[model samples]
Every structure is written in structure tokens, then in C-alpha cells.
Target: MFSLADLPDTIPIFPLPGALLLPRARLPLHIFEPRYLAMLDDCLKTQHRLIGMVQPQEGSAMSAGRLHGIGCAGRVTQFSETEDGRYMITLTGISRFRFSRDVTGFSPYVKAEVSWPDFQRDLGGEEEDPDFDREVFLKLLSRYFEVAGLETDWSNLEEADDELLINSLSMLCPFAVEEKQALLEAPQLVDRRQTLTALMDFTCRGGSSAPDELLQ
Candidate 1:
């Protein structure tokens, strides 16, 4: 239940590739690396318990690669420490942020200053895709799933609400990293649905997985 005012100007960032966390969606992460473990420990002591989930882009000389410009900030809602000393946590997406610049520091993990003005809607409650056509979308999804050799419970997807179904699919779908980023950057629920549908359709048509071609 974090309001816009509760969000911080800076937060610890976890730059994971192909991990897409949209607003109001939930992302479960396993923290095993020493730096991230330390990051999690520090986050626990804070009131907001927020972490920026960003994706690392390719073609970077740095070991962690260059981070994407935009990322979603999620609050640690559920947390548990495993017997092996790893941290398992579920981050409920609070909002998407525009990455300003990295804050150089002694901290092992990356930290950055972020702004949320561009995505004020992310702090709002669940959104409805009024234009969503479930049956058609599902049919397209079935074909895409079949082509991709993926399986799922049709009943569960059908039962989910508009936001849940779209966000879940956008997160779980085996699309390319940049495609996932495009979905994350989509301006609205309807726009996300269209982007997702286009990606699936492109894949179904035996298109290349290259992000440039897929998005174009």
C-alpha cells in the first residue's frame, strides 16, 4: 500500500536480464549472490523495502552490462531466508521508474536515482483493458503457445481478470529480452495487450526472435 509519496528518490537496483516486473505484478526472486544478499538485508531495515528491478542490456564491456533506461520498482512483500542462507522474496510491483544515473558508492550492488513522473499511473490500482477480447486473444495465445511448445492451464487463464491475464502472460511468455522490455515500457494496459499480441503473432508466423524486427 505504498503511495507515490512513499517512494524514495534512490534505491538499490537488481539488474537482471529478461526479468520483467510490471506495475501491480508480483516477481519472486532468489538472492544467492553476496552483494544481493547484502542488498536484501539492508532493504529489510528500511521502511519502504523497495528494490529497482532493471534489465541489463547486451554489448557492454562491464561485467553486469549496461542497464536499460527504464525499470520497475517493487516492494518486498513476502520474505523468507532459506536454510542454505539464501533469501527468497516476492516483490509486488509499485511503479515503473526512469533511470537517471547510477550512484557510485562502496555498495557492492548498483544504486541509482530514479524518477516516477512518466509513470504516475503505475501507483494507481489495477487497470482494466476495456478493449480486450479474451476469446480472440486466447485463441491467438493457444496458437503461440503451441508453436513455442509451452503448456498451461487454460481454465486458470480464462478465469483470471483482464489485468491478471495480460500481465501474467507478459511476464511468463518466452519472448526476447527487448520484447519484454517493450511490454514493460508500454504506456497502458491496452497498449501492452497490443504489443504482446503482436509479438505472439510474429512468433507464430515463424518470424525471427531478433527484437528489432519483432518490434518493428
Candidate 2:
């Protein structure tokens, strides 16, 4: 368990448009772009190894896009360099933070001042949501996979805890940027489970709509 007091005052940020991460979840990122390669190099050198996983606001460009207030900070738990000079890394979530402000001349990638007060609970790990219905989730997931021509290891899905299942489903789903953000912003486990359930249903039925519709 990571302590909030150990959290940094500043960290490097990755402004991927549709990528989302949740606390205790693992996000695997391939560092190929020059800018991100530079960023990874810096992280390896300094050993800070913490990157903020955030989405660019909807309808915005990466260079000039506004970020949603919330994002998760992850630690580089796995790393390997390839012959092509590319780095493959896995970041395991440490905690969620809200965007406070940005500063210049920090690093090649974007940097931001972030606060974790709103999501301190995430540090405690995933809480069980009694109101959450796992059967419903599996039913919808089965239907969506069938429709999408996807397959799963039923045993693993059955053994996964609430947090793992929700984050895995949320991360793997081909939902839009806003939908991903909604999963990131859910106040707690039950809310995320509920939101994810709706999204799964919509996908199973081949329905598409805005994030707000699914949340509602």
C-alpha cells in the first residue's frame, strides 16, 4: 500500500486521448514516439517512474486539449528495452489525483500539479459494493463478447475480484473517450460497476450514445 504522504508534489503526465486507468489496475504502454521515449528515459534516470494517466478532454487536440480534472498516477512496475530503442512498460496504479494546474519547463512530456484529497479512498484498495450485481455484469459481458466476436477465459473472469473485473472490462472495452473518463470518475466501486454495466449493455445491443447517457 502506498502512502499519501509519499505522493509527489509534481509528476510527468501522459495525455492520451482515450486511455484510462484506475487505482490497483495495470496499464501497459508502448513507448515509441520520440517525446514519450524521452519521457521514459527521464523516468528511468531519475527513478521517479511515476506517470499520470489522463485523457484529453473530448473534442480537443493533444497539444492544446484540456484535461479532465481527474487522473490516476501509476508507478513503473515493469520495464524492458527493445533493440529498436523502444521501451515497453507496465504502470500499476498508485492513486487517483485531480488536476490542479500545469507548469512549463518541467519535462518533454506535460507536467502538472495535482491533488489527491478527492480520491484518497483509492489508496485503500477496491471496496466491495453490496449493491453491485455480478451476475448481471457477466450476462451483459457474455452478450457483448458474442456480438463483438471476442472470447474470454471464463475461469479467470469468474475468479476476478470486483476491482480487477471492473477495471479490466473498463480498460479493454472500445468505449469512447468520454465513456472511459466516466469510469475513471466514478466515486467508488458500485458507481463504476453500475456505469460499466450500462456501457456493456449498450455495447451488446450495438447502441452508441454519449457518456452522460450511460451515467444517467
Candidate 3:
């Protein structure tokens, strides 16, 4: 069994993969799944059900439903109940966590004790990447859209901040699973930016010659 001895006593957790929540980000979630609904209810009652967003491993029965080791913890900041019995909620990321242990409890969702060592932004922190080329990113993204024949709202794209722009594109770009995992596990914003540039370049080139390969 895993242990929680080294982790913080209280932390809200949402263990969902394919969802990456970063600080200062507002992720809109459609909460219709029952297990996750229970998790939301628990969070509503507690006022801070921290969620650790991570991806599930591929082809591993033992780790099938469990989360990976690394994730970001998001707090349930805004919530409303929809007429369809679904929840329209927004999560504001607080910290990045490492799963130390999974708590066996009555809750349908698994809880992991986590540590937030790299949560804060500082001089040496991952947030210190200053050379992000927004103009270059936008040009490449525009070319990518044309090559793929995609329709998007460029107005919204223009106003997004660095994190939102990068993470949003990363989230929706239809990249490979392993590629998405690499983006998620990228240690710094600067590194993520670099990866985004490289991926965009690949998409632009491969998209023109072989659309299938670009998508793959």
C-alpha cells in the first residue's frame, strides 16, 4: 500500500486525466459523470475540494483508473447547478502536486496526499521564461489552421495570456497522447513554450504534405 506520511494533511483533489489545470487559469468543466458529481458535491460542502488533474496511463490494467504521479491541484472557485442536473463549474489552479499515496476511503473518487514544492512563481521558478515569442506563435498557429482547414475565433485568441494561450492550444491541438503527456510533464513554462513552437512547426510542415501524418 502507498503511504501519505510525507504529504500535507489537507488538500482538495480531483483525479482526472486528459485535463491539465494551471495557475491563474479558469477551466470550465461539464460535470455530469456520477463519480465526479460526488466529488463536486464533496468539494461544495468542504468549500475547497482540491483536484489533482492527471492523465491515465495507456494499457496498464494495474494503473487503469489511477492517476499518474504528477498533477496540478485546482480549487473549485465558481459553481452553478444547471437545469439538466449537471454542474457548470470553474477551477482555479493552486499548485502542482506529486502523488505520495492514495487514501482508501468512502469517497468514490481516489484521494492522494500531495506535496506542492514548485507551486510558487519566483526568480528561479519555471515561470521565468521571458523569451516566449507570441507573434511567432500566432503566425504559426494561423498557418496551421489554414493547412488543417479549421475555423476558430481569432478574437478570443488574440486576448488570451501566455499560459491560457499556450495551455489552451496544447489542450485542443489534437496531439498524440505521448505528446500531450510530455507537454503536461514539462517542468517549466519556458520548456513548454519551446515544445509548443516545435509542435507548431511540425504541424505546419506535415499538415501541408501529409495531413494524416500531421494529425498522427
Measured by lDDT, the strongest candidate is 1
Tens digits of lDDT, candidate 3, 135-154: 88799899887876787899
Q: What is the C-alpha lDDT of each candidate?
A: 0.88, 0.83, 0.65
Give a tens-digit lDDT track for model 2, residues 1-216. Answer: 677787887888898887788888999989898888987787777655788998888788775258888899999999999998998899998888988888688466788899988888988956787876778778888998887788989899989987798888888888888898888888888888888888877776777754466543
lDDT of 1 by residue, 104-146 (tens): 8899988899998889899888999988999999999999999
Q: Which stretches of candidate 2 lie over 4 Å from their true place?
A: 210-216
Q: Candidate 3: list runs displaced more than 4 Å.
A: 1-17, 59-66, 122-128, 207-216
Model 1: residues with Cα > 4 Å off, grouped in runs: 59-65, 210-216
- Which order, best to worst by TM-score? 1, 2, 3
TM-score of each: 0.95, 0.92, 0.78
Evaluation by lDDT, superior candidate among 1 and 3: 1
Residue-level error in angstroms, candidate 2, position 62: 2.2
At residue 118, give the lDDT of candidate 1: 89
Candidate 3 residue 51 C-alpha distance from true site, Å: 1.5
lDDT of 3 at 204: 78
The local lDDT score (0 to 100) that residue 192 gets in candidate 1 is 91
